[model samples]
Target: MCFGPFKRVCHWGPLVALGIIKAITFSTVTCLSQWWPPQQSASGTLVFVAFSSSAVLTLYFFLQAMFTGPGVLPAGWRPEVEGDTRYLQYQKH
Candidate 1:
């Protein structure tokens, strides 16, 4: 079977979306850092907050992509699973 134009477009759509997400995330983190003084503690805190927040957001995107659908996540981001499935268990809402 042949995939045709749609296959190619779909393949690149995620990457483009991911790029956009990264840019936005970076900008947001940078802006947030200004709220803290430029001391060593502030720098460290900024790093920690940015990394942790990014990880959480990325995970959310991945979950949305899966159980919900691909478009649930930003274009390029994808979710990953590992271990005893603890990462996937959801609390009943």
Candidate 2:
């Protein structure tokens, strides 16, 4: 998929994985809600809390992955010269 603002291209694999994760989370929450005690006054609150927490965690991880830099190049790797920067092809703005 294309991110319009960033002008970046993202592959479909991550999107598919995210959809699968959301589906699993919803299924789990549904199961939990059904298994919760019917007599309890807090069943709805419990499910809400569970779902919210899951969403929050997922967002946290997504942000973390987005913000983290790609990491350094291999050890001892260096360009031939200052004017020769062909190796630095993926510099971010």
Candidate 3:
């Protein structure tokens, strides 16, 4: 369980798992780079691959969060009662 910006409950397990995976991937890349000759082009390629992979993962997580339904609302929640529906906006559509 996680509390979002507005104190709404959210299932953040997947996000946490993604973060861990990202960290592990980065560490593995760093280790692999250390095994390669620093002056070699392969070393540069490894670095680029590491960064690109991280970037792709970041984008994937961003899209996943953006597309996931709104987080859990409080018990007996109602947008009209909350009175913020008029000001609410979604960038995607």
Model 1: per-residue Cα lDDT over 43-89, one tens digit each: 76877577768757895775466335333435444356445456543
Q: Which stretches of candidate 2 lie over 4 Å from their true place?
A: 4-9, 37-51, 72-93
TM-score of every candidate relative to the true structure: 0.38, 0.50, 0.38
**Which candidate number has the best TM-score?**
2
State the lDDT of candidate 3 residue by residue for 1-93, as single tens digits.
Answer: 345542322447656766776787678667766765346777677676776677688768765665577685665555765677677554553
- Residue pairs with colliding backbones in model 2 are none
Worst ten in a row by lDDT for model 3 = 1-10
Among all candidates shown, the one with the greatest lDDT? 2
Q: Point out the higher-scoring one by lDDT: 1 or 3.
A: 3
* lDDT (C-alpha) at residue 51 in model 2: 76
Q: Estimate the TM-score for candidate 1.
A: 0.38
lDDT of each: 0.59, 0.67, 0.64
In model 1, the Cα lDDT at residue 23 comes to 81
lDDT of residue 73 for candidate 3: 60
